[model samples]
Target: MKKIILSLIVFGATISLASAQILPAFQIGLKAGTNLSSLNSTASETFSGSNRAGYLVGVWTRFGAVGFNFQPEMYLTSKNVDVTSSSGGVTRAKFTSIDVPLLFGGKFGALGLGGRFYTGPVVSFAIDKNQSFDSAAGKVFSLNYQDQNFAWQFGTGLDIKRISVDLRYEAGITKQTYDGRQTRISLFNLSLAYSLVKL
Candidate 1:
Protein backbone atom coordinates (compact mmCIF):
# COMPACT_ATOMS: atom_id res chain seq x y z
CA MET A 1 0.00 0.00 0.00
CA LYS A 2 2.96 2.29 0.55
CA LYS A 3 3.82 2.17 -3.13
CA ILE A 4 0.27 3.04 -4.15
CA ILE A 5 0.22 5.99 -1.76
CA LEU A 6 3.58 7.19 -3.02
CA SER A 7 2.50 6.93 -6.62
CA LEU A 8 -0.64 8.93 -5.90
CA ILE A 9 1.43 11.61 -4.18
CA VAL A 10 3.80 11.80 -7.12
CA PHE A 11 0.88 12.00 -9.52
CA GLY A 12 -0.65 14.82 -7.53
CA ALA A 13 2.64 16.69 -7.52
CA THR A 14 2.96 16.25 -11.24
CA ILE A 15 -0.51 17.65 -11.84
CA SER A 16 0.32 20.59 -9.64
CA LEU A 17 3.47 21.24 -11.57
CA ALA A 18 1.69 20.96 -14.90
CA SER A 19 -1.02 23.34 -13.79
CA ALA A 20 1.58 25.87 -12.67
CA GLN A 21 3.38 25.62 -15.99
CA ILE A 22 0.39 25.87 -18.33
CA LEU A 23 -1.98 27.82 -16.12
CA PRO A 24 -4.81 25.75 -17.57
CA ALA A 25 -8.11 24.93 -15.93
CA PHE A 26 -7.19 22.37 -13.29
CA GLN A 27 -9.73 20.49 -11.21
CA ILE A 28 -9.58 17.86 -8.50
CA GLY A 29 -12.56 15.57 -8.22
CA LEU A 30 -14.28 12.61 -6.52
CA LYS A 31 -16.46 10.03 -8.23
CA ALA A 32 -18.57 7.11 -7.03
CA GLY A 33 -20.70 4.67 -8.98
CA THR A 34 -21.39 1.07 -9.95
CA ASN A 35 -19.54 -1.39 -12.17
CA LEU A 36 -20.99 -4.22 -14.25
CA SER A 37 -18.21 -6.79 -14.40
CA SER A 38 -17.66 -10.29 -15.79
CA LEU A 39 -15.00 -12.65 -17.07
CA ASN A 40 -14.85 -14.01 -20.63
CA SER A 41 -12.98 -17.10 -21.69
CA THR A 42 -12.46 -18.81 -25.05
CA ALA A 43 -13.30 -22.13 -23.45
CA SER A 44 -16.98 -22.93 -24.02
CA GLU A 45 -18.17 -22.85 -20.42
CA THR A 46 -20.87 -20.24 -19.92
CA PHE A 47 -20.07 -17.40 -17.54
CA SER A 48 -22.38 -15.96 -14.90
CA GLY A 49 -24.06 -12.57 -14.72
CA SER A 50 -23.09 -10.43 -11.76
CA ASN A 51 -23.08 -6.75 -10.85
CA ARG A 52 -20.41 -5.14 -8.65
CA ALA A 53 -20.47 -1.86 -6.81
CA GLY A 54 -17.37 0.23 -7.60
CA TYR A 55 -16.14 3.78 -7.07
CA LEU A 56 -13.28 6.18 -7.92
CA VAL A 57 -11.61 9.30 -6.49
CA GLY A 58 -9.01 11.27 -8.40
CA VAL A 59 -7.30 14.56 -9.27
CA TRP A 60 -7.44 15.88 -12.82
CA THR A 61 -5.89 18.74 -14.79
CA ARG A 62 -7.31 19.98 -18.08
CA PHE A 63 -5.32 22.01 -20.56
CA GLY A 64 -5.58 23.27 -24.13
CA ALA A 65 -7.60 25.71 -26.18
CA VAL A 66 -11.34 26.12 -25.94
CA GLY A 67 -13.41 23.13 -27.11
CA PHE A 68 -10.49 20.72 -26.67
CA ASN A 69 -8.46 19.66 -23.63
CA PHE A 70 -6.32 16.87 -22.27
CA GLN A 71 -7.05 15.42 -18.85
CA PRO A 72 -5.15 12.99 -16.68
CA GLU A 73 -6.33 11.40 -13.45
CA MET A 74 -5.45 8.81 -10.80
CA TYR A 75 -8.12 6.89 -8.92
CA LEU A 76 -8.81 3.87 -6.73
CA THR A 77 -11.41 1.36 -7.94
CA SER A 78 -13.22 -1.76 -6.70
CA LYS A 79 -14.63 -4.48 -8.96
CA ASN A 80 -16.71 -7.57 -8.25
CA VAL A 81 -17.95 -10.57 -10.17
CA ASP A 82 -20.34 -13.41 -9.31
CA VAL A 83 -20.58 -16.51 -11.44
CA THR A 84 -23.30 -19.15 -11.38
CA SER A 85 -23.48 -22.59 -12.89
CA SER A 86 -25.94 -23.38 -15.68
CA SER A 87 -27.59 -25.87 -13.37
CA GLY A 88 -28.06 -23.18 -10.65
CA GLY A 89 -25.04 -22.57 -8.41
CA VAL A 90 -23.19 -19.35 -7.55
CA THR A 91 -19.54 -18.29 -7.07
CA ARG A 92 -18.47 -14.80 -6.09
CA ALA A 93 -15.19 -12.96 -6.88
CA LYS A 94 -14.05 -9.47 -6.04
CA PHE A 95 -11.07 -7.17 -6.74
CA THR A 96 -9.79 -3.73 -5.78
CA SER A 97 -7.52 -1.68 -8.03
CA ILE A 98 -5.75 1.66 -8.21
CA ASP A 99 -5.80 3.16 -11.71
CA VAL A 100 -4.33 6.14 -13.56
CA PRO A 101 -5.96 7.34 -16.77
CA LEU A 102 -4.99 9.95 -19.34
CA LEU A 103 -7.96 11.27 -21.32
CA PHE A 104 -8.32 13.75 -24.19
CA GLY A 105 -11.58 15.33 -25.23
CA GLY A 106 -13.47 18.58 -25.65
CA LYS A 107 -16.48 20.59 -24.57
CA PHE A 108 -19.35 21.49 -26.86
CA GLY A 109 -21.35 24.46 -25.58
CA ALA A 110 -21.08 27.05 -22.86
CA LEU A 111 -24.06 25.56 -21.06
CA GLY A 112 -22.49 22.06 -21.12
CA LEU A 113 -24.97 20.81 -23.72
CA GLY A 114 -22.51 19.14 -26.05
CA GLY A 115 -20.83 15.74 -25.62
CA ARG A 116 -17.16 14.88 -24.98
CA PHE A 117 -15.19 11.83 -26.00
CA TYR A 118 -12.14 10.49 -24.21
CA THR A 119 -10.16 7.27 -24.26
CA GLY A 120 -6.97 6.10 -22.56
CA PRO A 121 -5.03 3.38 -20.84
CA VAL A 122 -5.25 2.55 -17.14
CA VAL A 123 -2.59 0.97 -14.92
CA SER A 124 -4.02 -1.03 -12.03
CA PHE A 125 -2.79 -2.98 -9.00
CA ALA A 126 -5.06 -5.57 -7.49
CA ILE A 127 -5.27 -5.29 -3.69
CA ASP A 128 -7.78 -7.97 -2.65
CA LYS A 129 -9.78 -10.97 -3.82
CA ASN A 130 -12.49 -13.23 -2.44
CA GLN A 131 -14.17 -16.29 -3.89
CA SER A 132 -17.18 -18.25 -2.66
CA PHE A 133 -18.97 -21.28 -4.04
CA ASP A 134 -22.44 -22.67 -3.45
CA SER A 135 -23.04 -26.34 -4.07
CA ALA A 136 -26.23 -28.23 -4.87
CA ALA A 137 -25.77 -30.26 -1.70
CA GLY A 138 -26.37 -27.09 0.35
CA LYS A 139 -22.67 -26.76 1.15
CA VAL A 140 -20.66 -23.53 0.82
CA PHE A 141 -16.93 -22.98 0.36
CA SER A 142 -14.79 -19.87 0.37
CA LEU A 143 -11.28 -19.09 -0.91
CA ASN A 144 -8.95 -16.12 -0.45
CA TYR A 145 -6.74 -14.97 -3.28
CA GLN A 146 -4.73 -12.07 -4.77
CA ASP A 147 -4.21 -10.80 -8.31
CA GLN A 148 -1.48 -8.37 -9.39
CA ASN A 149 -1.64 -7.49 -13.03
CA PHE A 150 -1.21 -4.56 -15.44
CA ALA A 151 -4.52 -3.84 -17.12
CA TRP A 152 -5.87 -1.48 -19.78
CA GLN A 153 -8.93 0.81 -19.96
CA PHE A 154 -10.32 2.60 -22.99
CA GLY A 155 -13.65 4.39 -23.21
CA THR A 156 -15.48 7.71 -23.49
CA GLY A 157 -17.42 10.20 -21.34
CA LEU A 158 -19.43 13.40 -21.27
CA ASP A 159 -18.27 16.57 -19.48
CA ILE A 160 -20.72 19.24 -18.39
CA LYS A 161 -19.35 22.03 -16.23
CA ARG A 162 -18.27 20.67 -12.82
CA ILE A 163 -20.03 17.35 -13.35
CA SER A 164 -18.71 14.70 -15.71
CA VAL A 165 -20.21 11.31 -16.39
CA ASP A 166 -18.26 8.50 -17.97
CA LEU A 167 -18.66 4.96 -19.22
CA ARG A 168 -15.41 3.04 -19.48
CA TYR A 169 -14.53 -0.51 -20.51
CA GLU A 170 -11.64 -2.20 -18.74
CA ALA A 171 -9.80 -5.37 -19.67
CA GLY A 172 -7.03 -7.32 -18.01
CA ILE A 173 -3.96 -7.79 -20.18
CA THR A 174 -1.92 -9.97 -17.86
CA LYS A 175 -2.79 -13.47 -16.75
CA GLN A 176 -3.52 -13.86 -13.03
CA THR A 177 -4.30 -17.56 -12.72
CA TYR A 178 -1.91 -20.50 -12.48
CA ASP A 179 -2.23 -23.94 -14.16
CA GLY A 180 -1.26 -22.29 -17.43
CA ARG A 181 -4.84 -21.15 -17.88
CA GLN A 182 -5.27 -17.79 -19.56
CA THR A 183 -8.42 -15.89 -18.71
CA ARG A 184 -9.67 -12.41 -19.52
CA ILE A 185 -11.78 -10.24 -17.25
CA SER A 186 -13.65 -7.18 -18.42
CA LEU A 187 -16.01 -4.61 -16.93
CA PHE A 188 -18.14 -1.61 -17.78
CA ASN A 189 -18.19 1.28 -15.34
CA LEU A 190 -20.69 4.10 -15.19
CA SER A 191 -19.17 6.89 -13.10
CA LEU A 192 -19.95 10.42 -12.05
CA ALA A 193 -17.22 12.94 -11.10
CA TYR A 194 -17.39 16.42 -9.62
CA SER A 195 -14.63 18.91 -10.33
CA LEU A 196 -13.17 20.54 -7.21
CA VAL A 197 -10.93 23.36 -8.42
CA LYS A 198 -9.83 25.35 -11.46
CA LEU A 199 -6.17 26.38 -11.77
Candidate 2:
Protein backbone atom coordinates (compact mmCIF):
# COMPACT_ATOMS: atom_id res chain seq x y z
CA MET A 1 0.00 0.00 0.00
CA LYS A 2 2.82 2.41 0.89
CA LYS A 3 4.73 1.62 -2.33
CA ILE A 4 1.64 2.23 -4.42
CA ILE A 5 1.02 5.56 -2.69
CA LEU A 6 4.63 6.64 -3.21
CA SER A 7 4.50 5.81 -6.94
CA LEU A 8 1.32 7.85 -7.33
CA ILE A 9 2.88 10.81 -5.58
CA VAL A 10 5.99 10.61 -7.75
CA PHE A 11 3.92 10.52 -10.93
CA GLY A 12 1.87 13.52 -9.85
CA ALA A 13 5.00 15.50 -9.04
CA THR A 14 6.55 14.72 -12.40
CA ILE A 15 3.44 15.86 -14.20
CA SER A 16 3.31 19.04 -12.21
CA LEU A 17 6.96 19.80 -12.91
CA ALA A 18 6.49 19.30 -16.65
CA SER A 19 3.40 21.44 -16.68
CA ALA A 20 5.23 24.18 -14.84
CA GLN A 21 8.00 24.20 -17.39
CA ILE A 22 5.57 24.65 -20.29
CA LEU A 23 4.27 28.22 -20.11
CA PRO A 24 1.86 27.48 -22.89
CA ALA A 25 1.29 24.21 -24.69
CA PHE A 26 0.75 25.72 -28.13
CA GLN A 27 0.71 28.86 -30.24
CA ILE A 28 -0.75 29.79 -33.62
CA GLY A 29 0.20 32.85 -35.60
CA LEU A 30 0.08 34.63 -38.92
CA LYS A 31 3.25 35.74 -40.64
CA ALA A 32 4.01 37.72 -43.75
CA GLY A 33 7.43 38.40 -45.19
CA THR A 34 9.50 39.38 -48.16
CA ASN A 35 12.49 37.61 -49.58
CA LEU A 36 15.37 38.52 -51.83
CA SER A 37 15.90 35.61 -54.21
CA SER A 38 18.89 34.81 -56.39
CA LEU A 39 20.12 31.96 -58.56
CA ASN A 40 23.59 30.55 -59.29
CA SER A 41 24.86 28.41 -62.12
CA THR A 42 26.40 25.08 -61.23
CA ALA A 43 27.50 24.15 -64.76
CA SER A 44 30.34 24.83 -67.18
CA GLU A 45 28.55 27.94 -68.44
CA THR A 46 28.95 30.37 -65.59
CA PHE A 47 26.28 33.00 -65.00
CA SER A 48 25.71 35.58 -62.30
CA GLY A 49 22.51 35.77 -60.29
CA SER A 50 20.60 38.89 -59.29
CA ASN A 51 18.15 39.34 -56.46
CA ARG A 52 14.52 40.29 -56.78
CA ALA A 53 11.90 40.97 -54.17
CA GLY A 54 9.47 38.14 -53.41
CA TYR A 55 6.75 37.86 -50.82
CA LEU A 56 5.12 35.21 -48.62
CA VAL A 57 2.09 34.89 -46.40
CA GLY A 58 1.55 32.01 -44.05
CA VAL A 59 0.24 30.55 -40.85
CA TRP A 60 2.49 28.90 -38.31
CA THR A 61 2.08 26.81 -35.21
CA ARG A 62 4.49 26.03 -32.41
CA PHE A 63 4.21 23.36 -29.76
CA GLY A 64 6.24 21.85 -26.90
CA ALA A 65 7.95 23.65 -24.06
CA VAL A 66 9.29 27.19 -24.36
CA GLY A 67 12.95 26.17 -24.22
CA PHE A 68 12.63 23.77 -27.14
CA ASN A 69 9.80 23.56 -29.61
CA PHE A 70 8.64 22.26 -32.96
CA GLN A 71 7.32 24.76 -35.43
CA PRO A 72 5.49 23.96 -38.67
CA GLU A 73 4.31 26.50 -41.21
CA MET A 74 2.40 26.63 -44.49
CA TYR A 75 2.68 29.55 -46.83
CA LEU A 76 2.12 30.81 -50.34
CA THR A 77 5.25 32.39 -51.68
CA SER A 78 6.91 33.78 -54.78
CA LYS A 79 10.57 33.30 -55.66
CA ASN A 80 11.93 35.44 -58.48
CA VAL A 81 15.40 36.01 -59.87
CA ASP A 82 17.32 37.39 -62.82
CA VAL A 83 20.38 35.82 -64.39
CA THR A 84 23.00 37.59 -66.50
CA SER A 85 25.86 36.08 -68.35
CA SER A 86 29.19 37.56 -69.47
CA SER A 87 27.97 37.56 -73.06
CA GLY A 88 25.14 39.98 -72.14
CA GLY A 89 22.44 37.31 -72.01
CA VAL A 90 19.67 38.06 -69.55
CA THR A 91 16.97 35.72 -68.23
CA ARG A 92 14.24 36.45 -65.73
CA ALA A 93 12.30 33.90 -63.68
CA LYS A 94 9.20 34.01 -61.51
CA PHE A 95 8.15 30.97 -59.52
CA THR A 96 5.20 30.63 -57.20
CA SER A 97 4.73 27.72 -54.81
CA ILE A 98 3.04 26.44 -51.73
CA ASP A 99 5.71 25.92 -49.10
CA VAL A 100 5.74 23.93 -45.91
CA PRO A 101 8.55 24.00 -43.40
CA LEU A 102 9.11 21.62 -40.49
CA LEU A 103 11.44 23.29 -38.03
CA PHE A 104 13.00 22.49 -34.70
CA GLY A 105 14.41 25.28 -32.57
CA GLY A 106 15.06 26.62 -29.13
CA LYS A 107 14.39 29.81 -27.17
CA PHE A 108 16.20 31.58 -24.37
CA GLY A 109 15.60 34.57 -22.08
CA ALA A 110 13.04 35.56 -19.48
CA LEU A 111 10.24 37.98 -18.56
CA GLY A 112 8.10 37.49 -21.67
CA LEU A 113 10.96 38.35 -24.03
CA GLY A 114 13.35 35.91 -25.63
CA GLY A 115 15.49 35.01 -28.63
CA ARG A 116 15.04 31.99 -30.89
CA PHE A 117 16.99 30.02 -33.48
CA TYR A 118 15.66 27.38 -35.82
CA THR A 119 16.79 25.16 -38.69
CA GLY A 120 14.55 23.09 -40.91
CA PRO A 121 13.70 21.50 -44.21
CA VAL A 122 11.30 23.47 -46.32
CA VAL A 123 9.54 21.87 -49.29
CA SER A 124 7.95 23.87 -52.06
CA PHE A 125 5.36 22.62 -54.54
CA ALA A 126 5.20 24.72 -57.65
CA ILE A 127 1.90 26.27 -58.61
CA ASP A 128 3.10 28.35 -61.52
CA LYS A 129 1.20 27.92 -64.75
CA ASN A 130 4.43 27.56 -66.66
CA GLN A 131 7.27 25.32 -65.59
CA SER A 132 9.71 26.23 -68.36
CA PHE A 133 10.76 29.52 -69.82
CA ASP A 134 12.36 30.51 -73.08
CA SER A 135 16.07 31.17 -73.23
CA ALA A 136 17.49 34.49 -74.34
CA ALA A 137 17.96 34.92 -78.08
CA GLY A 138 21.06 33.20 -79.40
CA LYS A 139 21.55 31.64 -75.94
CA VAL A 140 20.85 27.93 -75.71
CA PHE A 141 20.44 28.03 -71.93
CA SER A 142 16.92 27.93 -70.42
CA LEU A 143 15.31 27.28 -67.10
CA ASN A 144 13.41 24.02 -66.58
CA TYR A 145 11.92 24.41 -63.15
CA GLN A 146 10.95 21.36 -61.14
CA ASP A 147 7.47 20.74 -59.77
CA GLN A 148 8.89 20.33 -56.29
CA ASN A 149 11.70 22.29 -54.67
CA PHE A 150 13.52 21.01 -51.62
CA ALA A 151 15.49 23.44 -49.48
CA TRP A 152 16.84 24.18 -46.05
CA GLN A 153 16.29 27.28 -43.88
CA PHE A 154 18.07 28.51 -40.79
CA GLY A 155 17.69 31.76 -38.90
CA THR A 156 17.29 33.65 -35.69
CA GLY A 157 14.32 35.54 -34.26
CA LEU A 158 13.33 37.83 -31.44
CA ASP A 159 10.12 37.72 -29.48
CA ILE A 160 8.48 40.61 -27.68
CA LYS A 161 5.15 39.69 -26.16
CA ARG A 162 2.90 38.38 -28.96
CA ILE A 163 4.94 39.70 -31.87
CA SER A 164 8.10 38.15 -33.26
CA VAL A 165 10.50 39.02 -36.03
CA ASP A 166 12.64 36.53 -37.94
CA LEU A 167 15.44 36.79 -40.44
CA ARG A 168 16.35 33.62 -42.28
CA TYR A 169 18.46 32.36 -45.15
CA GLU A 170 17.29 29.59 -47.46
CA ALA A 171 19.33 27.54 -49.92
CA GLY A 172 18.24 24.92 -52.38
CA ILE A 173 19.42 21.37 -52.01
CA THR A 174 18.19 20.39 -55.46
CA LYS A 175 18.97 21.70 -58.88
CA GLN A 176 16.86 23.47 -61.43
CA THR A 177 18.10 22.24 -64.75
CA TYR A 178 18.88 24.67 -67.51
CA ASP A 179 19.45 22.86 -70.78
CA GLY A 180 22.58 20.83 -70.07
CA ARG A 181 23.58 23.23 -67.30
CA GLN A 182 22.22 23.15 -63.75
CA THR A 183 21.56 25.96 -61.30
CA ARG A 184 20.72 26.47 -57.63
CA ILE A 185 18.62 29.07 -55.86
CA SER A 186 19.03 31.00 -52.61
CA LEU A 187 16.97 33.52 -50.66
CA PHE A 188 17.07 35.83 -47.67
CA ASN A 189 13.78 36.19 -45.81
CA LEU A 190 12.57 38.77 -43.29
CA SER A 191 9.20 38.29 -41.63
CA LEU A 192 6.91 39.62 -38.97
CA ALA A 193 4.63 37.24 -37.06
CA TYR A 194 1.77 37.92 -34.70
CA SER A 195 0.33 35.38 -32.35
CA LEU A 196 -3.44 35.18 -32.58
CA VAL A 197 -3.69 32.39 -30.12
CA LYS A 198 -1.22 31.54 -27.40
CA LEU A 199 -2.05 28.98 -24.77
For all predicted structures, in order, the TM-scores are: 0.69, 0.82
Candidate 1 regions exceeding 4 Å error are 1-24, 46-53, 84-89, 111-113, 136-146, 178-180
Residue pairs in candidate 2 whose N, alpha carbon or C atoms collide under 3 angstroms: none
lDDT of 2 by residue, 1-199 (tens): 9999999999998876564445556899999999999776655456667789999999999886847889999999999887665455666778899999999998876666888999999999999923333355435345677889899999999989899999999988779875556788889999999999988
Angstrom error of the Cα, residue 162, model 1: value is 1.3
Name the candidate that leads on TM-score.
2
Model-by-model lDDT, in order? 0.63, 0.83
Give the distance in Å from residue 103's predicted Cα in candidate 2 to where it truly belongs: 0.4
Backbone steric clashes in candidate 1, count: 0
State in Å the error of residue 125, model 2. 0.4
Error of 1 at 85 (Å): 6.2
* Candidate that would win on lDDT: 2
